[model samples]
Target chain A: MSENSGSTSTNIFVAKLSSYIDLSIEEHQVIEELTQNSMAFDEGQDIIFESEKNSSAYLLQSGWAIRYKIVPDGGRQIISYLLPGDIFGFRESLFELSDDSVQALTPVIVHCIPAENIAEICDSHTNLSLAFTWARAREQAILTEHIVRLGRRNAYERLGHLLLELLHRLQLVEKAGNSDYFLPLTQEVLADTLGLSIVHVNRTLRKLRNDLMIELDPKTRRLRILDVDALSEATGYDQSFLDQNEKPSRSPQDAIGFEEK
Target chain B: MSENSGSTSTNIFVAKLSSYIDLSIEEHQVIEELTQNSMAFDEGQDIIFESEKNSSAYLLQSGWAIRYKIVPDGGRQIISYLLPGDIFGFRESLFELSDDSVQALTPVIVHCIPAENIAEICDSHTNLSLAFTWARAREQAILTEHIVRLGRRNAYERLGHLLLELLHRLQLVEKAGNSDYFLPLTQEVLADTLGLSIVHVNRTLRKLRNDLMIELDPKTRRLRILDVDALSEATGYDQSFLDQNEKPSRSPQDAIGFEEK
Candidate 1:
């Protein structure tokens, strides 16, 4: 059951934040109001580009977007995907130019807020800043895990781990007891993201389907995990990185003198 | 030519920060003072552990450290490397638990600064905050590139790209007009980082060395790029990701209403 208790549109990103930390009523109101100012985009459009002078960031009110980089050979690498309730462009508050691009993978609705407004909110609301910071930490952590997936896991493990990861993140935003979710990505996109050939991704999916571990519905673009635990086991998927605590429950042996993980 | 008029200690990290943006005199002094409060570590020591309650972060004043995650199966994935002048631990100001560990790759010296101090500096200095934020952005971008390496590049391309990367980063701190650098990593460590078997790593190294694109003196732990241009071309090693600007120059098609790059 969703923990939110109001208009679902405004509550989505807030509910997602709640999964990371608690927010005060005022903070909730700020995000809810931010959600009210939204825009829609159809699939396969670049929302941001390599050197955009974007003064505003965005909150995904609906649908999906992806961060990607185009290499010298004209190859595109999808850096990260943005789901509803995910915030984007806050980092530009620190820098002037955009380093990468964002393209909508599906029809998306984004809640736009100028960087100055975000800074304004952050200056007055410590909790809001903390919540946003938590979001960024998770984003960095997610990128770290993706690196591991690319460097270590085989194709089968990579596919399983990726699907489960998407499932878990999607659940945090709009999961409603369904083992299935819409993933509006073509096999080519999957190949690009997973560093596999389209043929390899297809073969891996076929194997997973044949083994009854997952079901893919291309017609509706829906993905259902027949067995989450099995997929997790097959991939040695560690969830701790995905679930970051707001405060320390248990400290590690060494405290403050290492590099970013 | 070295770009230092006074001492190398203060300018090491400053030089690094200068790669993206310029720093004011006050900011320079702040980092210099931070270096005065330094600590030493022996090789193979964990500076931060998997769930550490670190209230401070460190700057690599000397030697090298790596950020890594240990799986339940006892496998370790090195997320990123900390070269001299690189800072660590500031992210914990946002979250409680340390998601990964930092271990000294060599006998190392680090300038430790409490997270609060860094925060205080950022609160007062906009330029300093931009520097720190740039560091984090670069870190995230580094992880993203590693993911691409793992997902797409073959072993040859991965090793070539990684070496070029390390060389480029090392150049920022200490180039001495030499095309060679010290990389005190064993074949085992390379195997772990690149997701290859030790034998495979050895084979790749031998091939690169044999082809005269690169040279490795195993006993000296010295690596030399015989032809940086050829290696870059052979592997399609793009440096754009590593060289992130503090702001935009030419500008993207859409300015403010887009997503993070």
Candidate 2:
């Protein structure tokens, strides 16, 4: 598919990065140009494979994907979810190979930014550079949170915490409305992500429904938190970790060590 | 303590970075100068506090530390271990806050690099910039491995995998011998790190010993793996995630979008 200027594919990215740094009209146009060409992957397709040398970075334009790895016993562990506007396949910038693979959770579209372009783009556009750095840092923070959830929280808390996190992240890209989003994860997927059994995940979801904390419809694939505040409090989910409002005061030039013009 | 040009403290860092990219003698001296000044922290001291606005990054000069967060129920989860030659506290470069706290597991010494210095240094020295980027990516890889260990591995695999990881990391800095090191973690710390109960961790450690894969001296706090290959095979621990020998062939200038003079 081809995207024109101001298309939703590019707008979502601009909207997400805009939260970290203000971009000029020209900068927005540049981003749109970067995403003008697109690639598509069907559901259940491996966008990236383990041990592969991926020389380009990808921007997820639409749909969802998961970065995951399998253990010796063939148990899959999802490291993180890639929502719309998320960036992946960039880890090869330093490490020439990837140990974990990324698979599309749904039909997906992406924009490719060749590895060589990454350095040039960041050099010419300091604001976009900082925004990309912000995205990587944000991804790290999310992974750290996931570590905490897996290491400390119980099954109930893990499920609630993940749901709340997805809500906030999806909301950033305008993919979710008030406390609701079209969740595509099945119980088996949730079990793999949360390190729980499928039966346990189903039972926990039922408990959440019974407690009136969330409403999830399997057929519609819609998930809604009945009370965002209560679920957050119950799960000790702190959204501040994902906050993007507190931008550094320095100009992009100063931020990236360039003298202001 | 004051460090000279060739001190082990700085050499460890030089050694670690050299594995990623070769550094010129002048570049090595620059690193030495940057780490000349240092701060010390006692065991259990918080090097960084959650929610604190830390304006500097640190080079871990000596001793071990842990990045961790406390759950709402007061359960602690160790995010990742901060060993010598590690860099941290610089997330402030993008986001203005830190959500995870770092605590010294042993008496620690670290060299501080102010956040502002990071941008300036990276802009001025392209090689150093790439080295720092490599470090951050390596840390991310380590965290991903931790997630897989916690989410997919059993108690035996988790403990074995962690030990092998620590051994390899410590060896890179010369803190470990052929297959062993001074393990500073108590059973409680292991429990928090591995997401297991203290009793379970203790049992797993014993199983490893009984299986002729390792030896541990509680009094000396020394741990030695009798057969690194055997343990790695059993646990599916792949050390390639921590490998630093693969260097990109592109000039440092090209890697960071700079023209060669």
Candidate 3:
């Protein structure tokens, strides 16, 4: 375990969790104790292994990660991407054991919370229990939406939906900047996440760029949405799911600048 | 609308709701009034259209249903499935309006609970509120699992896992018999649910049958698991998730012949 070498301990992730429900000073002290010493992983590092006896949940302090599973016959599926402030591996540990694994997508910093302490916290605080329930429910909702995307949507729609979802979640943690967001994803990872071939993902991305809907700068890892409306129309993602309180700035017509497919 | 015929009024679906939380005589009277006349749909009938302004939630009195959305390119993705004693279309009324449609997958009888009445009930009973919260969380969990399935697993594994999931949910209502369960689904629907082509589904089903794992009697809509061990291995479904207590079963091996894939 290594200490996080940063000046900001009270970052957006911590701030967001506190907004949902307050923690007393003693509770904060416990949280510090739980995550006083944490680990950092470079890109593409596996944090949680499939069918492993994992007993800790992680709080994403910085960078990105993904939870996924590998199937027989050498196929890989990226279940979901975990952004800063997102909680991962909690649901899997709630029952029997983890059936999937978590991998770092970028140089990631994580605050590890022991499962036993989480259980104790839930027992003591009703609000914490409610928060845990909400967090799990939200995680499930994301999974459900992913099922829809994988099972039904086309590659173009899937990519568009994926971008919109990332943007929405990023906005929740105040990481999104205007229509542009930092997307530290490689084409290979995108293909794995969307269950498409790398060649296919590249072709589709070219198409999206040609349509003037989005711009991706691989070197800078910046994704700029030129037309949110066009993207939303293509993806069928209503920004209402982004945050219950924050209304979308641009209308569907103005956002994407393209006709709904 | 037609009245709940004969003793079906005392069905598990109706009884389970009241068991979780108290309903006053008036509340019970209201429930009776709401369900006194309800509608039944055969398999594959659309029960709730996407984005419709219906302010009623359907209670599953019998059979199964699926909530889903159709993509622009004629692809259908099933978001979640509703089993007997399950409720659907309630979140639309509770939160914002729904963005998805729901359809019956088997001959289903449903009692429509009005949104206004549900709100009144929630305001009156704290237990009902908690139960409602739990219900929503559970629904979200199902969706999350769907996401994981869609984002990660392969066609064969997805299909097997989906079948196992349906079987487990059906067992809760005692609708599953031995190794056989009624599955009124076509290859097209299965393809949509699993994010595969109908041809692929057919091929996968044949593979399972050839492996001496499962047999599907299409004419009778009956599915027979020939080898529970093989089936579980193919699906990677843990029987513990099916336990009603939300805890893994004590004797998981006896509960089901599940072997991780």
Please report the candidate that would top lDDT against the real structure.
2
lDDT preference between candidates 1 and 3, better one: 1
Query: For candidate 2, lDDT tens digit of each residue in B1-261?
Result: 333342443356776676667666667787888877778888989988887778788889889999999888888999999999898876655575357899999988888888878887876676787777777788889999999998989999999999999999998778999998999999999999999999999999999999999999999999999999999999999998887557653355433221121
lDDT of 2 by residue, A1-261 (tens): 334332453366777776667676667788888887788888998888887777788999899999999998889999999999998877766575358999999989888888889878876676777777777788899999999999988999999999999999998878999999999999999999999999999999999999999999999999999999999999999998888656553355433221111
Predicted chain A of candidate 1: TM-score: 0.87
Docking level for model 1: acceptable
Give the Cα-based TM-score of candidate 3 against the true structure: 0.72
Identify the runs in model 2 with alpha carbons over 4 angstroms from their true place: A1-10, A249-261, B1-10, B249-261
Candidate number of the best TM-score: 2
- What is the Å distance of residue B248 in model 3 from its true position? 8.0
Full-model lDDT for every candidate: 0.74, 0.84, 0.69
Q: Which is the better candidate, 2 or 3, if ranked by lDDT?
A: 2
Tell me the deviation in Å of residue B11 in model 1: 4.7
Candidate 3 lDDT over A166-256, as tens digits, reads 9878877888987889998888889988988899999999999999999999889899989998899988766554333211111223222
Alpha carbon lDDT at B139, candidate 2 = 82
DockQ of 1: 0.37
Task: For residues B115-156, write the lDDT of model 3, one tens digit per residue.
Answer: 778755654544444445546645644564566567667788
lDDT of 1 by residue, A1-261 (tens): 112222443367666665555556667778787766567677887777777777687887778889887766677778888887788877655564347788888877777778768767766665666666666777887887887787777899888898888888887666523578888889999888988889999999999999899999999988999988888898888776776655431122322222222
